[model samples]
Target: MNDALLALTPTLELPSVAREQALKKQTNISDYDFLLGWLYPEDELLPPNLALFSKTTGPVFIDFLGGKKNHRRQFGGGKGQPLARAVGIASDFTPKVIDATAGMGGDAFVFATLGCEVLMIERSPIVAALLQDALNRAHLELQLEAEGKTYRFDDDEHSFLTATISRMQLVNADAADYLNHTKPEADAIYLDPMYPEKKKKAATNKEMTALQGLVGPDIDSSKLLEAAMTVAKKRVAVKRPAKAEPIQLESGKKPSASIQSPNTRYDLYVVASTQS
Candidate 1:
């Protein structure tokens, strides 16, 4: 780990019974501070307050199965949203999206809920572990929901949540390396590189502030874009703030088109051929 990451390392706290599972699944625990606390398989922190949480930002988690923000996004005009349109969700084809920089997996969850199979890759071990914990908890909740034992959702909602969770996959890997080696071609490759911080106070929210402090910005995002162009079958979509310029490209590569929303834009780069 780098010096910056070493300084910001998180402590993994799991229940005594789950210690073996944590050790087997989390190989990087030795590099971090280990604590003993129970994470009650449900999407919550158990008693004694032991959870897979961030010291800087308390109790970081992923909850696509609930919350008003996520629910509003999933059941609202998501399919007609600019991101969906940029990835050709309106077309006769169902696109499989690869979220190269799945920091919090928020966008990946959005795509998955919209019926697009999304594969997420995160490079930061801390962030990856947090995301993995969130995903595991989410899957468990979905399973319980499917069996009508948790989260009072209608039958249609339950089925939709189950399908959405099934469509999503996560991996802790460098985006460039994964793209270089992955065999199956993704219909759309998505990039959401961290935007450079503004020079003013309160420039962003708490979550983003904590995130930028941890992972920093994706300085090599252009290289990631290059790798995506090589593997994506239909297009590579890059998400950016509406006013920000599109991602930098090498000498010849360029984005084919752009889809714009009030707050963000999707720069679509079409690949030359289907074969790698």
Candidate 2:
């Protein structure tokens, strides 16, 4: 584990059950700088969720069962969504995707919901723990729904959530290393390297702020992209800020095409051959 990761300690307020879970997760992680613990909701019936707490920021956690994730899953423009299109999801084709920088697994979930099998790779054990916890909780809800037991969420929600979780896989490893060593076969490889924050813009959301602090910038993103290019059978899509330039490659290669949205851009590197 990184030195920064080694410094984390569980919060004192974590309940017994959550504490146990956090400790179990810690067995795999060496350290962390922030508080690794669970946050219980005001409603006693709700299950406790894992979070990373810092002095300045609110609790940072991944939540797929409720909140914005649910809303996006239910009505985020379906396959027509920008991310979906960028990764080549269509009626005739749904590419299996590898999310190389699967931060909070937010975009990976989106692809999963759209019926794409997604492999999420995260290097940080801290963030991966939070993501795994969220997935575990979501799976529990799915299992409850299968047993016809009462759940906090509605019936219609379970169908998609179940399918989505089933299609998503998480792995904790460095993206470049994983891609190069495993050589996993996938139709698309998605990269969303963390770019430097703008000084003039307002502060980013709590999740992003905490994530940036924990993982820092993706300085080796170019190397990761090179590995991805060699692995992806069809294309590699890199997410960039709307105004930011595309990632520079040492080979001096350029994207085959670019897709733009209001806030983001996707630089598509159409793989000419898998051998590359």
Candidate 3:
């Protein structure tokens, strides 16, 4: 592993349950020798038993069952949001989405809640571990909700939450490799590669900052776009900063259309064969 990636996990300690889950995931933490183990106090406010803490950059973890994810699902726009528009969601047609870069699983969660079957691929083992933990917990919570055990949400929210879990599948792999070798059929492929921030100081979000620190920029996003174009049956959606230019594929073609919001722009590459 590179020194920068190693720096992302200065301390990688797992709680007992997280260790058990890691074993089931076939991921051995011992292989990452550079990560030291630092025990947290039992009363610490962390939700997931495991977390990746960087002294310089705060800890990062996933919590789909509660906290930010729950809040977003409850109040966030369902199918009317810009991302939904970018992916081409409609009242009569809900396209299957392959979220090639499933960072933290936010977009996938939204798509799933909107009745789209979403296949999420996360390449980083560390990020995948966090996502898997959240997915497992979310599934359990959905089961409880189905049995009328949890009352934190109403019937509509509960139903959508259940659908999100049932429709989502997380896979740990590179998006390019998955699209190339697996040939998994999907109506659309969504790419949210980390583009260069327009303003260095304007990027204040902790999660995104830590993510960029770990993964760096997606320098080969154009190549990924090429792979996505070949695989997507309907279209490919690339999320970009508002000012960034649309991705240019190997054929020197840009997105056919683009939808813009205040903070981001979604560039859509509609396949000629699958246009509606």
Q: TM-score of each candidate?
A: 0.78, 0.85, 0.80
Q: Candidate 3 lDDT, tens digit per residue, 1-276?
A: 223324435423322223233334344544542122223324333223335543344456676766777777768887888898888898888999999999888889888878899999998777776677678767766676678665566887777677778888989988898899988889999999986655645746666766676677788898888888889999999998888878766688978999999989999999989766
Error in Å for residue 165 of model 3:
1.0
Better of 1 and 2 by TM-score: 2
The residue pairs that clash in candidate 2, if any, are 5-31, 5-32, 6-31, 6-32, 7-32, 8-32
Q: TM-score for candidate 1, please give it.
A: 0.78
Off by over 4 Å in 1: 1-56, 201-203, 274-276
- Candidate 1 has an lDDT of 0.70
Please write out the lDDT profile of model 2 over residues 78-150, one tens digit for every residue. Answer: 9988899888899899999999999998899999988899999999877888888788878876786678665
Q: Which pairs of residues have clashing backbones in candidate 3?
A: none
Q: Please, what are the lDDT tens digits per residue for candidate 1 over residues 68-171?
A: 53666656686787878888787577799999999877788888888899999998766676666667766766676667566567888777877888888888
The residue-level lDDT of candidate 3 at 143 comes to 73
Candidate 2, superposed: residue stretches over 4 Å from native: 1-33, 41-46, 274-276
